[model samples]
Target chain A: MSKVRVHNLFISLDGFSAGTYVTADEPIGDARALFGRFDGRVINGVHHVAEPITADRIFASAWGQGIGAEIMGRRKFGPQSGPWDDDDWRGWWGDAPPFRTPVVVLTHYERAPLAFDNGTVFHFLDADPATALAFARELADGGDIRLGGGPSTVRQFLAADLVDFLHLVTVPVVLGEGTSIWPGTAGLADGFDIETLTTGSGLTHQFWNRRR
Target chain B: MSKVRVHNLFISLDGFSAGTYVTADEPIGDARALFGRFDGRVINGVHHVAEPITADRIFASAWGQGIGAEIMGRRKFGPQSGPWDDDDWRGWWGDAPPFRTPVVVLTHYERAPLAFDNGTVFHFLDADPATALAFARELADGGDIRLGGGPSTVRQFLAADLVDFLHLVTVPVVLGEGTSIWPGTAGLADGFDIETLTTGSGLTHQFWNRRR
Candidate 1:
């Protein structure tokens, strides 16, 4: 079965996953500290490192494994809200996105799909978590769907019980107030088995796998 | 110097240190899951176990080391609020509380000191964080003071920058909504050097030491 997975979601000690403001200039806005310690090398297995890959890298490497499609919020696709007037803003990742798979951008506006030279393609759709998952599933081609997030998007899918596996990295910083993923998720832990690992770099990684 | 330390403070993934509504029947209320995995042996030393003590146990055993007096919120002492009319209700620990030292309970109302055979003495006073810390410092007799918490009390000391060391245990659970210790603490981690450790039992222990 193609699982719905969320990987490498960074959250502050205060449970904030993203900063309040999101502009084109500051894509992540005030939440830059959330990703300050995040090394993008984890996405591709960290094979370039001369030192032996640590457990954190191994756990984070799961982000790209067997993922054929990614379902992300419109804000994650670009810092634009409402109708997408700035059509040139492909994404923060530029023309060639690292996600070489079909990406479903959850938005209320209707826009033509943007295809990149790589396998990355962005499909804008106005749909709920289930509908968005269905769209991504068709393009996933039997592989799992990664739930790419900007906090609110992950919260939506989690609230709908669509997430099968979650990889959350808890940073030690305190962002007093920001976008939180744990809100309204009262007994979300009851449905899954959680494993926690703290790396030497002070990042606590949690893997939540849904119980069969 | 008599340090102000907090040990074994458990919080859910949502940063809720305690559940709402405390009663005699349910002392911890809806947030019992936060303390579900807590072993009392960690407070002292887990020497009773024939096997070697894990790093988590070693880290947790610091609770009893070099601690003389404790300062806690009124809620941590009992469920009753506003003037203690029930004189018979000594505390939740019955006759013998684990705190075998002077304990200053921050309250608006004053009550006669309650002395226990275990050397536990409850001193209720209407004081702020600084005043309460002064009272505890005097009682500590040069020993470090432990900041016993029910969440809000910790936040008070943290906000006042009175806390010297903090031992926060992040449990794998979501309380959804409850009493949090992270509110109003925008940069609580800035003053401290944090060390993260995850135990085999899926507990993430964060030790935040004041950077002097």
Candidate 2:
């Protein structure tokens, strides 16, 4: 069965998934402390890595396993909120984006799909969480759909009970105020079984798997 | 060389130290999920017990070490707001209270001190965090003062930069709404060094020591 999974979501001790402000200059704003220990290498599988992968890295490396397509919030694509006035703004990534699959960007304003050389395509659509997931599912073929988030986007999917697996890294730092993923998820644990592991570098990795 | 320390302070994944509502019957209210793994045997010490001591137990056992006096908020003593209309209402603890030293309860109304057989005395006083700490220091007699909180009290002491050491247990549960200890505590991690350990039982224990 094709599942919907979220991986490597970093949250502060105060439960802020992202910083309060985000601009073109500061992508994460005041939440830089939360990602101080993030290892981008973990996005890929851990088996091929030769750098003596730690438990934290191994846990985070589950991002791209069998995921065919991704659904991301408009903010994750760029800091621009209103209409996409700048047609030149491809993304934070250069010409070659990381995801080698169809990426659906949720936005109110419509834009033509942009295709990259590495099989990465940006499809803009103004749809709800379920609708976005359905679009991603069709694009993913038989593979699973990855729910990429900037926090609010993930909260929407989580609120709609569409997530199958969630991997959250609980950092020790505390952000006084920011966007939270746990605000409306009061009884979220009742439908999911959680397993936690704390690495030597002071990172707590939590895996929430939806009960069948 | 007395220090102000907070221990066994349980916080949910969303950073709520306690629940939203508190009454005479439900002292913790909706925050019961945060205390599901709390083992009260560790408050005194980890030694001399027949049960196997885990890292979490050793961490929580620091609560009573070198703590001669305690300072707690009024809500922690009872759920009553405004003036204490009920004189007969002592506390949640029966004849024998836990603290074997003087406990300063921060309240607006004036009332005589209540003495327990276990050397626990509840002194009601209307004072700020500093004033309350000073009173507890006098009663402590050079021993450290433990900050007993219902969340708001700890936040006041924390905002005042009076806490020397804080031991927080990050539970896996998520409380959607409640009283948080990190609302106004932005940049709080800059003042202290944090150490985190995840126990085998899936409890993440964090220790914050204020820099000298």
Candidate 3:
């Protein structure tokens, strides 16, 4: 059986997922100070979980403990204007992006296949939330499938009660207004259980595992 | 009299102000996300003591409200190994950086005077922390001297008990090891008192005021 998980979804105090004037060039605002929380090899270890590399290096002692597949919304894939123009704008990351394993991108517009040399293939699914979860479950192969988000997508999955676990890295600065993960969403309080709460680097990393 | 205040200084769980591998190109790791909390213009009007500006706008109407001058350490100004280079590499911001006031750089190496067309001047100070504070005090003209940090410089001033107030944005990510602001060489617990704490966007922003 496969499990669904959402990881590293960021939010601002005013319920905005991102700043309003955000563009492809400036995906994040005041990014330097906000991202300063993860600087050393520690973050790299976690990032490598999705990146493509030799199996030895992928599973090497240097890499963090656990991570399976990645799932994100199209907004995170690129700027939100045109449908997929060309393959040139793959993402912020260069040729070999951070995520190497199977990645699922949720979108309404239909697009052709986006294949990269590093085993990264952009699979665009127009199916509903249930269909996406089914595909993720199949891909998980008994492992955990991460829900990489832009807030709107995460809210949809959470509303459906499809996520099994969540790891939120909450940054301190607040935009006060933008896109938020919790607004207009409901039913999250039912089956969710907080597994652990830890504090480090002035940031609070919370983990919640779904209760059966 | 110039009052010195520390604002938006982030810390790690291990007491490292920033991780070990801070370079000139990227002074603070994960800094983008750290500052993301303040990116939105909507929240800017509410949370920020300062007003928010559009992305295209460089100068804000409330640029010099609480901030009288900008202060930073040498490493944050440029690379660590090189001697005092020319003003080519002023602080990260380009020619017309955001700060429209006297920007001070704390450095041991003295170089030729560098001036920008905009209201930014790279004033290098060789004197001790007290001298630098005095200069900023005079420059502030009764306003607060904002302590823009790189940790070590902040630690020095904090050790001398020169800081009047401190604002720490606690992001919720654990690097497991890195530079810390509070538990630095000089114990921050000794003189600083946490005056206020606000939680939003999964981050806890703490304000520490000097006991006086």
| TM-score of the second chain for every model | 0.92, 0.93, 0.76
Model 2, A79-129: lDDT tens per residue? 898988899889877887778899999999989999999899999999999
Scored by CA lDDT, what does every candidate get? 0.79, 0.79, 0.57
Candidate 3 per-residue lDDT over residues A130-189, each given as its tens digit: 888777667655545667776778888887777776655566676655666786556675
TM-score of chain B of 1: 0.92
Q: Candidate 2: deviation at residue B117, Å?
A: 82
Per-residue C-alpha lDDT of model 2 across residues B1-212, encoded as one tens digit per residue: 67888878988899998888999889888888887886642233322111232345434544554578999999989999998789999998778677889999999986999998878999999999999999999999877888999799999999999988887888889989899999788999898877676766777877777876
Give a tens-digit lDDT track for model 3, residues B79-134: 66457445566656667655566767887776755677867677787778889888
Across B1-212, the per-residue lDDT of candidate 1 in tens digits comes to 67888877888899898888899999888887887776632233321111122334434545554568999899989999987779898888877787889999999999899999989999998999999999999998887888999799999988898988888889898889899888889988988877676777788887777886
Q: TM-score: which is higher, 1 or 3?
A: 1
i-RMSD of model 2 (Å, 1 decimal): 15.3
Off by over 4 Å in 1: A40-52, B1-212
lDDT tens per residue, model 1, A1-212: 68898878998998998899998898888988887676632243321111122344434545565678999998888878887788787888776787889999999997999999979999999999999899999999988899989789999989999989887889989998899998889999999877676678788877777887
Q: Tell me each candidate's TM-score.
A: 0.50, 0.50, 0.44
**Lowest summed lDDT over 10 consecutive residues: which window, candidate 3 chain B?**
B51-60
